[model samples]
Target chain A: MNSVLPNRAWTFISLLIAMVFLTLQNNSSAAQFLPNWPWLVMMFWVLTTPHKVNIGSAFIVGLLCDSLLAQPIGLFALLFSLSAYFMTTLSAHYKGLPIIQQSLYIGLFYGLFQLCLDVFSYASKPENSLELNLWPVGLVFVFWGAVQYSLERLSRPAPIE
Target chain B: MFNYGIHERIRIKTALASVSAVLLLILDLHFGMMNQARTYLYSITSPIQMVSAQISLQSKNLHQWLLNQEAQEETQAQLESENRMLKAQLLQFNHLKRENKELRALLSVSPSQFATRYRLAQIISIAQGSGQQVTQINKGSQHSIHAGDAVVDTQGLIGQIQHTSLLNSQVILITDPNQMIPVINQRTGLRGVVQGNIKNLKLRFIPQGSDIKTGDVLLTSGLGQHFPEGYPVATVDHITQHNNSEFLTVYAQPIAQLHQSSYVLILEQGAQ
Candidate 1:
């Protein structure tokens, strides 16, 4: 929550969030509404600084996440890069929309990301079904506004007297 | 780390990144080229995971304590949590009883028969999203927990260790679609393969008129030598066959308590 967080702080924060993500996955009670935190964070960064942090950064971050979380090795890498593609191309349209509508649009895309993941899973094993949970698709978007505000604040230069 | 000033190349770069990621996934899953890197990353992240889990648990307890200060709300929440805890405990008793019997039998068993050793492992985290019913356990390669070691609870077989690091390992649960275990009908001795069906499991490949019946208990047949023989896997719930279909669609409920088990036993066969 510092105004100017250090690099180590950022690394720690990422790891901390990764740790909480494990808890979120294990939380069977609210499985339907669990937002992909790292995806939200990566999306925020991509929208804010499209040129500096783009698809390549998304893929690397996802690779790191995949290793950290003990997922199928490059699973997160694939999901994040694909998401980065969608966000980079679609950011222009959402930029003109209101915050509420913007969140909804992003949520719609998140569902698409989930679909891509499930499709990949189905490819790996034909026994699974393609399930798209639309009920809580946008509900996970409730944190989008907060994520947007935080990233914006963190990126801002300190005000001069 | 990409910081290209040319905006035109961004789309091409994104496509390239996605393609590379897909390649990486295939290489990692099939060839396991990234296991060492994953293990090194685990060293960095697992500690944070343990700390965060503890902090989360503490925060929840504090919130529960605050709620408990009010008399009326206290009993309702208290009883609910207690009920949940009691249910989990009831499930755990099966392991303890089996362990007691097994340990006693091990005393007289020869070295060949005593090839298996059981170690208790704590579930660190479970996979999120659909089609990925995997979990990470606290024990890993250092603990001699090899990949494909059968993971069970007090009741029955749950899963097997899919991958192992120095300090932790990943388990693909029997409920995962990619995970399939060979099981046999305890009563009829009919053999079949059961695929993990997310929350439930489904028996596949059995012929339409196979002598399987509802309520038949399925035990691991150890066909692939993946899981040990004779551990209860699932109980047949029902079988439905479409007209002219060769295979009957069979639904079976898992005998093991799936995700609810906080602790599980890892069977390290031929443990040194």
Candidate 2:
């Protein structure tokens, strides 16, 4: 139990640092190629440790993301918390899934996430003529492949199982 | 503790959190009561953002340092010539400024007539999300930055301050979907409204036979009193007219370096 506390704390801190770093990269005009990394990080944590990353934690992180991005307050919070809940319910079966299947799950989840953001954005501001970008949905699969490979190489224990 | 049941507790908590999130969403959409909360959160994140920005700036400087010596020498020579030209122009510009100030005083249009005060702000972060075109700056209410204050780069009008926190603020760029600036055609002197989106600005309500042409410059008309007068906004890019329509579709590209630049002047309006 003592060892678990320190490990959990370190993991939480590392995740926060990663989120902040990703947020900074996202905001920089120099890096327009980076995707929604915070979302990926959140999803990774949720899949790996549902017991540790609760809905409240997701909500807070989402709110922080919204603030950093200058988006409508609570918009990301709502989306992220809902995603956390969905991931928590599916984590049991998800942990046992093969790498290919896991990548598909991430693609599906991220696709839905981007779709919701696009739809909400369009509805909120009709003048932008913002289209539901299927390209980002496609890109999520590619990103998941890279993210999963990196996570597998980095983690001491198997993250998926 | 009593057996509250872990699974039941998880289900109940998730439901509660989701409901609260929905409530927050409604509050944010309808009333915007959450802006204060957002401001506080932004303040908490400001330190990390500032450090990151500094790191990025340093890295960019290092990249420039690593460039070939010939390129560096060329840049230095160009800068020196530009500096000399600016110095020569500054003398004449100062004389003209003094004469203009005296004339304005004679006309009873002194500093009281408009915002002479401005605050220099550094762009901290831009909204990487889709839809809105907001940029965060280092100045905030502590620096007297208020909402609706006009922001401008060296080239032209950038946008208006949309929200203010203690040490930071959000600026809605002129290209944001919700932005509307009253602009006048520099060539024809015809007043029209310029609306913006992610793509480009559209000059709306233009008469079919309006003299606005491609490449015509547009400046803020200061009709709404939000932005100061005579700031360059955009240049007319394309014009389209349908046979049956009474209006022409005129698209303009913003003159402000909205994405590339990282600093701006926040115009603070004074008592008129």
Candidate 3:
């Protein structure tokens, strides 16, 4: 129990730091490659420790991201929270799946998130034309690969099992 | 503790998280109170930003220095030959002063304007977000820069100051969707409102039969009182005629390099 607390604390701090760095990089320029990092972090946390980092924490982090990045305030929060919840509920069934399969699934999840963000932004501001560049979506697969490799290396004894 | 259940603990935690998220969203949306707090917090973190910017600047400078050294080495022999040739050419050109003066007067000229009070400012930081594209300059209220003061660079009008802190001010660029400038065609004197489009500015409310044409210069009419009179805003790049509408759609490329430049001049209020 004592050991578990420190690990949880470290994970939380790492997630927070990732969120801040993502916000900074995303807000600086329109053409950036680093914004997808937070989604990877969120996905990794959800897959590894659902109980320790719940949907609520995801939502809060998403809200801060939205605020700092100046997207629709509640949009990212709501979507991220829902994504975490879905992952947590489905993690058990998918846990036995191969890493590449899991990464493809995560990439699809990120693509859907991007699609929703586009739809919401368009609906809110009709004047701004939607430029859907597939580059960011493609970049997510790279992040997914990294997440898969890192998670495997950092795997620990499953508390719930 | 005797009656506590696992489900109860989960519910309580979930509820607490939900409430907090809602509260944060409300604070972010309703009043922009959190934005103010964030700005204050950003000021505290600005030293870090400054250091990072300096590192990037130094790297760029180093690259430029290396390029200059290479160019000097490559040009050393050629420049020496060219210098002797240019000296001879200069002696020949010195006798053609009367011809040069006649040609200059025939060309189109920038109009003369009265001297105005100007405040030199360095861009401290650019707003880091999608919603508002603004730049913060080092000079602010302490420098007598009030809201609505026009900011310009050497080329032309850049923007107007929207908000001011003690040591910083936010300048909303002319390319921003929300910014509008009152302008007139310098050649035809046709007046129209130059509104910022997403990427460029468009002149709205110009009548279909207006004398405006491509390559005509647009100057601030000073009707808005926000910007000074006769500063170049943009050049008419294209004019489209609409069959059904009374107004002609005019698109002008902004003269100021709003994205690339780092320095600007904030015109002192009442100077114009």
Best by lDDT: 2
Tens-digit per-residue lDDT, B1-272, candidate 1: 76666555777777788788778777777886865776566666666556655665576668877764577577889989989998899679667756766777789752222225899998766666533577777888889888889999979998988767777777889988778899989999999999988778999999988998889999998778788777899999988989988999999999998878888999886442
Q: Each predicted model: what fraction of the native A–B Cα contacts (within 8 Å) does it retain?
A: 0.46, 0.53, 0.12
**DockQ of every candidate:** 0.41, 0.50, 0.19
User: lDDT (0-100) at residue B176 of candidate 2?
Assistant: 82
| Candidate 3 local lDDT, A54-148, one digit each (tens) | 67777766765554444535656777776776687767777888877887788788778877767765664588687554566777766677765
Off by over 4 Å in 1: A6-19, A22-26, A64-76, A85-131, A135-137, A154-161, B1-5, B25-52, B56-116, B188-192, B204-211, B222-224, B240-249
Better of 1 and 2 by lDDT: 2
Tens-digit lDDT string for candidate 1 (A7-114): 334534753574467455555566556666777777776775666667887887777667555467678887888788778877777788899988887787788876
What overall lDDT goes with each candidate model?
A: 0.75, 0.79, 0.70
Error of 1 at A130 (Å): 5.3
> Candidate 3: which stretches are off by over 4 Å?
A1-35, A67-72, A90-97, A121-130, A147-161, B1-55, B58-62, B65-130, B135-149, B162-170, B268-272
Indicate the DockQ of the complex predicted as candidate 3.
Answer: 0.19
Which lDDT tens digits does candidate 3 get at residues B34-114?
A: 655545443443443344345445766788787867686778879899899988986886556445555666775433233
